[model samples]
Target: MHTLKVDSVQLAFNDRKILQDVYLHCNQGEVIGLLGRNGSGKSSLLKIIFGTLTPSYKYVGIDDEFIHYGYLNNRIAYLSQDSYLPRGIKISDLAAMLIDQLYWDDFANLDIYKNHHHKKPEQLSGGELRQLEMLMILCSKADFILLDEPFTHVTPVETQYFKTIIKSISKTKGIIITDHQYYNVLDISDRVILLTDGCTKHLKNVDDLVTYNYLSGIK
Candidate 1:
């Protein structure tokens, strides 16, 4: 079973603290949503999990095994708000770069990759590009996936599309996602972790989140 366990992780940047005593646990068939306001270290935490950002203090694990920052580039898949795809790169080639026919064939059956078969990453619209990036992540060999603001630039339809993909991924893989779109996040998330003032509090349900004023517009 794919699982991600982050224990007592702490991080700082340029003498400023970002994450303090952070801990997270996720497993297959579960969707964990990381929620917080802007500049609240939401993305930083995701980067720390994916090893893109080095932590001043930390311990992140996967399947009970310790994970190192240097080697996480290949072991985890990350989708950022920016498509960040290389300009002029072909979409088919990008997918191929992640995985080959054996994996692509299995991944393509998922609804997210249906329309992204051969489209160029640069030629795609914002939604298409985001979807492509997500599809690539799904097809990769990474045991854990970190998605940062996947619905930020996409349309409502695209948002729903990606949500379905996320739900599907959680059924077979461990996924940690952060999005400002709180409503949609709640709709798909099996568990919600609210980050406030650099601390995390797990909410049991949507009502719990609302009662705690974690849901937007409820305060």
Candidate 2:
């Protein structure tokens, strides 16, 4: 089983302290949610963990070994809010680049493909683009998947489909996702990380969310 441990990570950008003494732990077969307001270092922490940005003190361990970002693409897949599809690429091409069966007839049955009619990335709407982005990410076979706002701009139906896929992925892989859709994320997350002013705290249950005002009122 895969796992990640972040020990007292700190990062700064040109004198701005983006992340401070943050710690988090996620286990295999678990989906963890990272929540916070805009510019609160949520993405910075993810980047530090994934090795995108150099942390002031990066103490990231996978399973039990310490590693760096140079090898992350082979071990983890990070999906940003933007799709990295080549400017002239088609949906089928994007899937093929990631994995073959992902663009097969089985995946074709998905609403995303059916609605987009296998259109080129540049021609698709934002929601459709993100769906394609998600497909590529899921097909990559990475042990750890970090997704930022996976549901943003997607339709409700598409969001449901994506959530199902994420759950399935978590059955075999570790997932760390951040989104503005806190309630929906809480529904699927095995653990929740709430960030405020550069500090992070783990929320154990839905009750904590309600008690901490992270929710309107738990359902």
RMSD of each: 2.8, 2.6
Q: How does each model score on lDDT?
A: 0.75, 0.77
Residue-by-residue lDDT tens digits, candidate 2, 48-155: 777877876978888878978823556777887766777776676666556545336656676677776567878987877877778767656577888888888887
Off by over 4 Å in 2: 70-73, 100-111, 114-119, 210-219
Candidate 2 clash figure, as a count:
0
Stretches of candidate 1 off by over 4 Å are: 70-73, 100-103, 106-119, 210-212, 216-219
lDDT of 1 by residue, 87-126 (tens): 7766666666786454677775755456665656666777
Number of clashes in every candidate structure?
0, 0
Task: Output the number of the lDDT-best candidate.
Answer: 2
Error of 2 at 143 (Å): 0.4
Model 1's C-alpha root-mean-square deviation from the true structure amounts to: 2.8
- Model 2: weakest 10-residue lDDT segment is 96-105
